[model samples]
Target: MNLKDLPIDAQPREKLLARGPAALCDTELLAILLRTGTAGRGVLQMAGELLGKFKGIAGLLHASADDLKGFKGLGGSAKRAELIAVIELARRALAEQLKERTVFSSPDAVKDFLQLHLANRSHEVFAALFLDSQHRLIEMKELFRGTLTQTSVYPREVVKHALAVDAASVVLSHNHPSGSVLPSRADEAVTQTLKAALALIDVRVLDHVIVTQGASLSMAEKGLI
Candidate 1:
C-alpha cells in the first residue's frame, strides 16, 4: 500500500511532525528519507527490506555507492545520493563531536565513529585515532591494510604518523571482516608493541578497538590495553 493509504497520523512524515522522530520505527524513519517507493513496493516496505538486506542501520552506515546500485527503489541517482550523503553526514557529525570533547567522555561515540570508518571492509584495515593532550581527536588515519598482524602493521610507520600528527595519545583500531569483534592473539601482540613504541615517544595507547559490521570491542575495557 502507498503511504497515502495509511491514516494521516500513521504516515511517517505526519507522525514525525506530530509526535517527533523518536516515535517512528526504523522503517518509518528510513521511509521519510527515501521519500518514495518503487512501482510495486511501498516506501515503508522498501525501507524495511533495505534495512534487512543490510542487517539494520549500522550496516547501512558504511554502504558504498556501488552497494546501492541495482537495489530496487534506489535505482535512481537521487535516492542513492541521498542515502550516501546522510551516511557521510552522520560520520562527520560524530567526528565533530569527538573533536570538541574528551573522547573518553563518550566512549560509545568513539566506538561508533571507528565502526563507521573501519567496519564492513572485505580486508583488514589497521587505523589509529590520534588525540591531543586532552584526548580530543586530532585525526584518524588508516596506516596499514591487508591482514592485521604484528609484522604487517609496522610500529615505525604508526610512530611516524603519530609524531607527524603530534599526538599525545592514540586509540588503535582495526576491522575483523569475519564479523567477530574478538581480538586475535596477533591483535593483542600488535597492540602491546604499538603501545610500547608510542610510550617511548611519550604517547599513550588509550585503547585498541576491534570492530565488525554491527559490533565493537574495546581492549582497554577488557583490560587488554
Candidate 2:
C-alpha cells in the first residue's frame, strides 16, 4: 500500500511527529535519510527492502556502494547517497558509545568502564590494561585466551609481554562463560605468580578481574592484586 494512502496520523511521517523519531522503524529511519525513492516505490518501502537485505546497521555498514547499487531499483548515485548516509549513522553510533578509558581508580570503576565492551564477547578474552604512573589508562591489549577451563599462560611470559609493551603498570582481566565471577584456584595461582614476576621487573600488577555474564569480581578489592 502507498505510504500517503495510509491514514494521515498512521503514516511514518505522522508517527514521527506525534512520538518523535525514536518511534520510527529501520525502514522509516532510512526513508528519512533517503527523502525520495525511484520508480513506483516510496522511499519507506525501498528503505524497508534495503534494511531486510542488509540485516541491520552492522550488515549495512559492511555493504559497499557497488553491492547496494545492484539492488533492483537503486541507481549508482542513489546507492552512493545512501552509503554516505549510512556512514554518518555508523559514526553517530560510535560517538554515542562509551568514551575512551582515562583513569581507573576503583575496581568498580574499572569493571564499569570495560563491561560495555567485554559483556558481549563470544569467547573468553584476556585483556591487559596498561597505565601510566598516575593510573591513567594508556591502552589495553588482548593477552591470550584458552578454549575452556584453562589458559596456558605463563608468569614469565606476562612479564616479557609487559616489558615489550613498555607498560609501567598493568591490570589483568578475563571472562567466564559459566557466569561465575569468582577466580578459580588456578586463576589465583597464576595471578600471584605473575605479580611476583612483574614485581621483579618494576612493573605494577594493579588488579585481576573475573567477569561473568552479569557480575564481575575484582581481586584487588579482595587484596589479591
Candidate 3:
C-alpha cells in the first residue's frame, strides 16, 4: 500500500489524528517509523519482515541492535533508531502492566501478567516478583540466569531485592526454556531454600511458578512446598 498515494490528509498519521492511537498494532506503529519503503515493499511489508526476522514482538524486543544491523536496509543509525523504538514499546507495555498493581489477587493473574514477557527466553531466568502487604505486585527483579537444570536462584538476593522495594511478600517465577512446566529437584530445593530464607526476614513467600509455552505450574497449587 502506497501510503502517500492515499492523499496527505488520509495517511495513517492523519487518520490517527482524526481517530486515535489505539487503532494500531506493533507492526503498524513500526510501519509509521519506517515512513517509506523500497520500491517493491510498503512500510508494513518492511516492518513485517523485521518482526519475522526476530520471530515476534517479544523476540524482537530481546534482539540486540547489532544483530538487527545485519539486515540490508535495517543497518545504519536510522535502523538502530527503529530497533530502539521497538524495544522501548515493549518496555512501556510491561511497565504499564505493572503500574497501579497494588497486590496480586490470584495465581492466575501473576501468570497472565508475566507469561508473555518470559515465554520466549532461551535461558532460564530466576525472577522475583515483589509484592506489598496486600499482595499487589511491586516490581519484578531478575536475580540470576543459567541453563535449564543449573540456574542458581539465590534466596538471599531475592529477599534483599524485596526488602529494597519494601515488599511484604514475594512470588518466585522462572521460565522453562525447554517448554516443560514440570518442576525439577533443583526447582523444589530452591523453593524450600527461598521459603526458609524469606521466613527469617519476615517476608512471606507466596508462590514459585514455572512458566512454560502452554501452561504454568505453581508450587503452591501442586503442594510442592
Which lDDT tens digits does candidate 2 get at residues 1-225? 556667887677778988999988778767766666767987778888887886664446546677677886676585577676767665444323312434553545677545534543557777777776666666666777764333476566677777776778888888776767788887888788777888998998888877765578889888877
26-132, model 1: which lDDT tens digit per residue? 99999999988888889999999999988888878878899987678787899999999999999999999999999999999998899899888888999999999
Candidate structures ordered by lDDT, highest first: 1, 3, 2
Query: Which window of ten consecutive residues has the lowest lDDT sum in model 2?
Result: 93-102
Clashes of each: 0, 0, 5
What are the per-residue Cα lDDT tens digits for candidate 3 across 108-220? 55675567567667788888788778776678877788853334666667777877898888888889989789999989888888888889889988888888655788888
How big is the positional error of residue 162 in model 3, measured in Å on the Cα after superposition? Answer: 2.9
TM-score of each: 0.96, 0.55, 0.76
Best by TM-score: 1
- Candidate 2 vs 3: which has more lDDT: 3
CA RMSD (A), model 1: 1.2
- Residue 107 shift from truth in candidate 3, angstroms: 6.6
**What is the alpha-carbon lDDT for the whole of candidate 2?**
0.69
Judged by lDDT, which candidate is best? 1
Give the range of the ten consecutive residues with the poorest summed lDDT in model 3: 98-107
Candidate 3 has which clashing residue pairs, if any?
102-136, 103-135, 103-136, 104-135, 104-136
Ranking by TM-score: 1, 3, 2
